[model samples]
Target: MSELYDDFKSIVLNKTPLIDVRAPVEFKKGAFLNSVNLPIMNDEERHEVGICYKNRGNAKAIELGHSLVSGYIKEQRIQAWSDFIDANPDALLYCFRGGQRSKISQEWLAERGKEIVRLKGGYKAFRSYLLRELEESTLHFKPIILGGRTGSGKTIELKKMSNAIDLEGLANHRGSSFGQKITPQTSQINFENNLTYELIQKLHDGFEHLVLEDEGRHIGNVFMPESFISLMAEAPLVILETPIEHRIEITLNEYVIEAQKMYECAGFENVLEAWQESIQSAMNRIKRRLGNQKHSEVCNIFEDAVQEQKKNGSYDKYRDWVEYLLREYYDPMYDYQIQKRSEKIVFRGNASEVHEYIKSVTLFSGRLK
Candidate 1:
């Protein structure tokens, strides 16, 4: 009998390699941050097996699973697993509940003279542990929300500090309509996996305070973990300030110029047109909030900016629309939200000043030293 690993910290804190034996579809729905999917069954086989399990019984499902993965096909799968364990001497294998699939993989590997650890409760156990950890982090982490108007360099500042968790970075979003990157976002499960993994590591590292940008509940289509968001609302805030001209420059550089760069290398041409559509689409998300007249006006201003870029190939033309949206749309909404927060505003300063202040105040100070 092989040892089962139901211990949570033992698994997460260790660097031992893990082989995820869930189906590709299961892995795609959500997976650990460092895990690589080497599914025991692909989607179709898993689906048929699932139906058998539901309509018939465990014996029928097991028999059907065996039938689908026999002879050369079985050999191929085992060969892949053997190659992986060969490369990773200390690797562990896991299925959804650390059940039959992982055990079967172990038995086959043993036949091939390979012995590997089996994660006792598998992916489900690990996932439950992470959720518990995230909920606990709300209690452990002394969160400080870094508030700012658009283009305030909030994310940049967070990147410079060890204490901050860049939620926007994790979500691959900037928490705004124009914040979408050309790269596709992860599934919600993947997002939470990444976040919870980083979060618990930070908590374990003894960082007294965790800084994060002020984001609405959602980043793109993915939502922040509810517990973390609740903590953020009640926690203290430090707002960053930059001159309007500076903010406008940063916003255009990120949303327009850098966005153009992203889509260009994205292996897709007509990126300029894509950039325009992004701006228009982003504006559409706020149509109701911005009111009918303002929405139309903002879209028109945006169109005029793109036309200017077409004639002259200069992106500086976007400054007008960016400035308009910030002043007219985003700023008002931000103010309204801030007013509703129960936590006190702790400090307010520009990027340089706030970064310095954060360094001085945070427990992670001198960490780089």
Candidate 2:
């Protein structure tokens, strides 16, 4: 008999390699960062098995499954499992609910002299544990929000802190219209799972405070849990106050220069054309808010900037539209929102000063208490 392991905490903390034997479609719906999809049944096979199970009962379903997976197909799957076990000796196997699928995979591996353990209650059990831990984690740490205008380097500064959680980094977004990265944002389940894992690890590492960049409930398409969002709302705010010119430069580098490099590396045949189109699209998303006249003006400036960059390889012209959008669009919106939370403001300074201020404040002391 194969062993069934239920030590999900240890598995998560150590990032134990996992063979997910569910169907590929099931894996795509939600999965752990450490787990790889090595399905016992493909989508079509799983669908067939599911329909059989519903109509013909478990015994008949099992018989059909064995018939469908027998012979060379079974041998190929066993070989793949053996290869993975050979590379990751400590790896575990799992299915959706720690039932027949994982049991069969474990038994097959055992037949081939590879004794791998299966997760006791599988992915469902592990995911429940993680989400519970995430909810409870809020009690263990005080939150300090880093807030400022768009492009105020909140993400950059958050990365520099030992106790910070880079929510934007986890979401794979910068939290704005122009914030899309070269890679698509993570699925909502993935984002939440990764965030929960980070919280667990950070708390385990003895961090009593968590610093997060100020953001609404949503980061791109993924929203933070409401409990976590409520905690952040009441947390102390530390504003990093960079000058307008410096803010524009940071925005330009991230959105234009560095972004261009990313598109090029991702093998866009016409990098400039692709990137410019994305920028135009992003600006258009805010067209209603920017109002028609301002949108047209900013778009014209952007077009000129694109033309100049093409001709001279200079990004200086790009700054004009960036500054215009910042002054006219983002700043007013940011200021309006920040005003509502003025009572929560605790510290305000340039990057170095804010860093010093954060260092001096003890967790669960002063404003946090």
Give Cα-based local distance difference scores for all models. 0.83, 0.90
lDDT of 2 at 63: 92
lDDT of 1 at 32: 79
Task: Give me the displacement of residue 230 in model 2, in angstroms.
Answer: 0.9
What is candidate 2's lDDT per residue for 4-24, written digit by digit as tens? 898887887898899999998
**Residue-level lDDT tens digits of model 1 in 1-369:** 456766666556665678898899888888876577887889999999999999998999999998998899899989888898888876788999989999988888889888888887888888888888877778776787899888888888888877788888888877787778877787898888778877777766778788888887889889988887788778888999889898899898898888888889886679888777787777888898899999988888888888888999877768898899889988898888877773568888988889777777773432431
- Can you list the residue pairs that collide in candidate 1? 5-120
Worst 10 residues of 2 by lDDT: 360-369
Which residue segments of model 1 deviate by more than 4 Å?
A: 1-3, 363-369
TM-score of 2: 0.94
Name the top TM-score candidate: 2
Q: Give the Cα error of residue 48 in candidate 2, in Å.
A: 1.4
